[model samples]
Target: MLKTILSISGKPGLFRLVSHGKNMLIVESLTDKKRVPAYAKDKVISLGDIAIYTNETEVPLHEVLTSVKNKENGAKITVPSNTNELRTYFAEVLPDFDRERVYPSDIKKLLTWYNILIGADITDFTPEEEPATEETTAETETNAEEKTE
Candidate 1:
């Protein structure tokens, strides 16, 4: 669902990918529906591809956003301007998030993005499960054979 949503650096809000051109992409603003051509020089990052740093590993942005949504009961959260408050809020959502790697600004951006997504009625953040690998499929077949024997 978030595949077409893009966060272009230097742009104020999110954009939905419309179509691709030879050296650029045609995008429409999620907020104003203003269609614009994003050049190859623009830094465009998909919301699906973004992740947050955790102590154990990186957690996908969608999961973090989902947690925020669930915690706030689908309401927009007031982004804390104070650094300590921001840290506390992030800790509540992701206790094991790497404090050093995840800065206050990053947290602020996440909260802002979450609010934007929520306002746009794009709350579904559930990612599709990956298909079983060849090795796992083979193991399942072998186990079935043994069970039948």
Candidate 2:
């Protein structure tokens, strides 16, 4: 089921819920005023608040109650990652390439593509063979003269 959060205080008030899909919640505050909380999208439900949703986290009102209960009773709670945060995480892991070299402009995928595209071979690293030595130049000159003779 989709996760949610709800909060309940001593007084009657509304709470907010934000999820990728609709979920059910039961909030009964047994405090002094017996505040019956309602579901809200943004702020509190009774206040007609809108909720925020994405791949990362959901600040749903109903889940607020669950969150508070967990805190009071020592239950476990896990916060979801935000979509933007995850994207940024991936971006940081991606290699930093010369901007001029990448074509399509997708930094993330381009990093992976580059690793597969080109590779070095043993021949490409043949030990620094000394430059054309003076002896080699003289041998070539002598060969040319022999042909003329």
Candidate 3:
């Protein structure tokens, strides 16, 4: 899901979280399947945490991505190079997207990200449910034992 997908600053494309290292993360590029170490100094952001400014409120990136998917019928879209046309295409996808706050460059990036995601066969934009941790499982067992006592 989006949580495991990362966008490293200065990096060309999105990366999938492969493993954790000391003071760094091992990330696999979504485009090339190449593994690289994203150091702690790098500004690594999960796609799940990103949101787009809207007229009324902020919309999560996943929702926006889903909207784009719906608009494109799950196919890669040709991002318009012209600024005005790009805005028009984005407006069709998100009608209430803030015209003032959302720059054309931002829209272009979103569309490009969508195309990359589609090309990588990453269609699911929803967040996956987090699995229970050891601490939580132990707490649950303790509670059950206390109740039985």
Q: Once superposed on the true structure, which residue ranges of model 1 sit more than 4 Å away at CA?
A: 128-149
lDDT-better candidate, 1 vs 2: 1
Candidate 3 residue-pair clash tally: 0
Model 2 misplaced stretches (Cα beyond 4 Å) = 1-44, 47-55, 74-149
Residue 36, model 1, lDDT: 97
- Candidate whose TM-score is highest: 3
RMSD of 1: 3.0
- Tens digits of per-residue lDDT, candidate 1, 79-141, equal 999999999999999999999999999999999988888888888987767799999999999
Each model's C-alpha lDDT? 0.92, 0.32, 0.93
How much does candidate 3 score in TM-score?
0.86
Residues 81-148, model 2: lDDT tens digits: 55444344333333232233333333333222222111111011112345898999999999999999
What are the per-residue Cα lDDT tens digits for candidate 3 across 13-121?
8999999999999999989999999999999999999999989999999999999999889999888999999989988888999999999999988898898899999
2 or 3: which has the higher lDDT? 3
Candidate 2 whole-model C-alpha lDDT, 0 to 1: 0.32
Question: What TM-score does candidate 2 get on C-alpha atoms?
Answer: 0.18
Model 3 vs truth, CA RMSD: 3.9
Q: What stretches of model 3 exceed 4 Å from their correct place? A: 131-149
Ranking by TM-score: 3, 1, 2
